[model samples]
Target: MSASPGQNLFRQPRAVFAVAFACVVSFMGIGLVDPILPALATNLNATPSQVSLLFTSYLLVTAVAMLFTGWIASRIGAKATLITGLAFIVVFAALAGLSGSIDGIVGFRAGWGLGNAMFIATSLAVIVASATGGFAGAIVLYEAALGLGIAAGPLIGGLLGDISWRGPFFGVAVLMAIALLATVVLVEPLPKPAVPTPLSAPIKALRHRSLLTMGVTALLYNWGFFTMLGYAPYPMELDATQLGFVFFAWGLLLAFFSITGAPWLQRKFGTAPSLYGALSLFAVLILIIGLFTGNRWTVIVCVIASGVVAGINNTLTTQAVMLVSPVERPVASAAYGFVRFIGGGLAPYAAGKMVDHWNMHVPFVVGAVAVLIGVAVLTTGHRPLAAADAAMAAGDRHTDPDEVAGEVADEFGGAPDAIDFEKELDHR
Candidate 1:
């Protein structure tokens, strides 16, 4: 069948913009809070480790919560979940603004993380379902927005922190409210997913060799990413404004790569090659930063290089998973996100201990090794999605007509009471 005209534009442009805008707002909140961590620690008379919990706790919950969000959205509908999640962020951000102590802030951050989990899971699914063409551009756009948000967080957070540590939290509350409104006014409800696979189904998919390996790869990268992003400025003894500049540079490099480099790299090199290359480069960059810590120029160069690597590597890794199982993209995204968070949660605490017992450089070395391992994991025996796509096409060409028909029916919401997947599996 011929594809519908203008379908590509209709599916992605509108919904993707809305989702990206929502992410921008929520991520801005996250970014804004980051630069204020030290101030908050001092203000609350808490240890640096305790204040760092602000990032760790939020990510931890969001990571765990994301695993279930896909199934929940399928049951409740994406629009409802999106709206409700934004509400959590908006309300809790305000609550965070009111916090007078470290514990209060940590609690609020965790609550906001729950909202983020909902937003991330629902937004991702909606974007994929709403997108018409292949997902390379769409994924890049999503990652770009994320990078922009991360970049903006420190700058804005620094500005607000200059006034008061409480200031950024208040701004976060306001931005989230604005995003909530935008989502309602600009974004349309996504078509409900046709087949709501059981939670067990995703678990089963995870057992697939490729999926399991990618999950581990994602976890290790997240551990490295959160470690680097979370701690890059701490040992430099930089003020908030200086740190903000560094973050801005980092985000700018990421956005540049996300917007420009990603498409070209994916197109020229193919997803797996681009992904593996990016991973290798990122590992090297992290090590460079750690090893040359005393050389200011080299450190700055390494930071920018790291941003480029992160943008390309992350986008391609996600693309790899989606290529293999387009239908399971949401579940896979959530599962990968969950693993990433588990890794993220562990990194800070582990790195914090190292910072206490050894030296700050210790975490950087560990993080570098972790990224290298991720590269190996992602590249080892990795059957590229292109190969998978080709094999499927060949399979379709060779398969019996009845089998193909049944596969189509099963995939796209077959006629009510018309097909049994169990029967089809038995036939296979």
Candidate 2:
């Protein structure tokens, strides 16, 4: 019999734990710099727009690098990709800490993004392949690590930023190095893809209706997500520690909802209704923040509240993309990552520029509208998402094809069974 989800969580292998630990640290990089943005501006003698480019550079590189992740992984294999990505992050994060100027830090961050793309794209596939209790269990574990990382990032940033603006960067370097060591030691190497994925694969994957639909929706959703994440710190005008605590609260709600709340909601309301309600609620929250940008208490409350919906959206949207797409999981992830990261990368810089020129309120107002646009985009994918939901309900989710093929090859001590391969690929 299949293991229960609760039991599956504990039954994971050492390799799973190693990679999951790395996932937690990798995700922390997303929010690790939040507590230090204001500090960076002060110490580096930069404007908000300049500091915001830190995100722009990092995400832009990550977005572009995602296109090649599938190609590289298919050639070099998963373990090499994971280690290379981690090494890049460790080196660049430390370099970012050592930089003397904002421009220097931004340059290093871009390098960090390239590594991030490789790691993020491959890590999901790894977890999906390695975890037990089926796809749902793996997703829960992945989302949980994401939550913990996101939640801890700002707290770590806050504590360290109290020492210096550079402290958080160095902290990520140290922690990620440890994660890299764990991954190298614990995670067993996997066989290379039997058929190499072309470099054009991720780009081609976007032609699929379900992948494109979810990718575009995530693009729109990210505009709102990053607008709040990138700019909210400025309006609050709190010190590093206070800003850390506030976002820590936000990240906690994000973590809780992602791991526990999202699955519950998906089972109860189904994917479509759950996403619609959550995105709508999130758009409204953004509107409130826009309307009350000048009110510190109101901004803080709205920012924290946004986490609940954001958390739900994060988990549900990821699950939706994986389920609905017909492409290999890694390719789907890369294609989806390419679109959303572009939006995520662009939004913060845009928000910063908007704040620089127009007003703080304008960015949030625009963000609210963008999120509502995501709601509309999601509507276009109703058919595919419905089918995916039905598959989940029927316990018919597809396993990772590369993993299935590897297992078949091991069992037969030669080429995989073509029938078995086709069955796994077409399972959904």
Scored by TM-score, the top model is 2
Q: List candidate 1 segments past 4 Å from native.
A: 1-13, 132-134, 294-298, 386-428
- Model 1: worst 10 consecutive residues (lDDT sum): 1-10
TM-score of each: 0.85, 0.92
Q: List the global CA lDDT of all models.
A: 0.70, 0.86
Q: Please list all clashing residue pairs in model 2, or write none if there are none.
A: none
Candidate 2 per-residue lDDT over residues 56-163, each given as its tens digit? 899989999999999999899999999999999999999999999999999999999999999999999999888877777788889889988988999999999999
Residue range 319-374, candidate 1, lDDT tens digits: 56655532355666777677777787778767778778987687878988998798
Query: What is the Å distance of residue 134 in model 2 from its true position?
Result: 1.2
* Candidate 2: 10-residue stretch with minimal lDDT: 412-421
